[model samples]
Target: MAGYSRWIKPEVYPLLAPVGAVVGLMAMQLVRNVYTNPEVRVTKQNRAAGVLENFEEGERYSQHFVRRFVRGKRPEVMPNINKFFSDPE
Candidate 1:
């Protein structure tokens, strides 16, 4: 037990702990941006309702300037052209 104490740096570890925490938070944000759905939202308020649009009015938008080679060209427009139904009132 005495020998193990030599390897642990109680003072240094506490000081550096916050650095590790900040790095983790920044990393999470980066991932979120990269994986964010690049789609034009309809409703703007209700995302769940948009899911239903995919079949009824929504569609997959490669929606970008650079075309995809594997599956085929996605929509030329970016962010996709989302369709929404509004109340006529």
Candidate 2:
């Protein structure tokens, strides 16, 4: 332990101390930006809205197809051809 401390004192600590402080401050700033930045919040909200809009569009298209073809009854055979190639195991 003493030898490790001695090795750290003059060689490692002086070089690492300031770098560590700067890195710590940078990490704190990054966390603060993620938590408090308005631009980041708006971008996140826009991305979420885009995703939700895409999902709703897909749902509406599927519903329209189901209403047209399947009506109120379930299909006897699966409509998708790709299901045959899928691994059952």
Candidate 3:
């Protein structure tokens, strides 16, 4: 513990507990999902149904708020810089 002070900063100590708690919660949820979630327990009979479900999920995710907003905008890399250089004086 004493040697840890030399490697880890004192400022970071407060952040460690919250980060550990979040990681612990995520791990517990993962375990619970593995045992109780139907999506995890796929069978040969319902494999096609699972594929359809996945496709629908994909469509929903693709139509997400952020994706919808960005989709309407131009697909540009550094549009401002390009505009500035492209402008005629």
Which ranking of candidates, highest lDDT first? 3, 2, 1
- For each candidate, C-alpha RMSD in Å? 19.1, 17.0, 7.2
Candidate 3 lDDT over 1-89, as tens digits, reads 98988999989999999999999999987886665455665566755565344666556544766778888677888988888899956
Q: Could you give candidate 1's per-residue lDDT for residues 38-70 as a string of tens digits?
A: 444434475565444253232234332333353
**lDDT leader:** 3
TM-score of each: 0.31, 0.38, 0.43
From the highest TM-score down, the ranking of the candidates is 3, 2, 1
Q: Give per-residue lDDT, candidate 3, residue 67.
A: 79
Task: Mark the 10 consecutive residues where model 1 has the least summed lDDT.
Answer: 79-88
lDDT of 1: 0.53
Local accuracy by lDDT, each model: 0.53, 0.62, 0.73
Clashing pairs in 1: 53-58
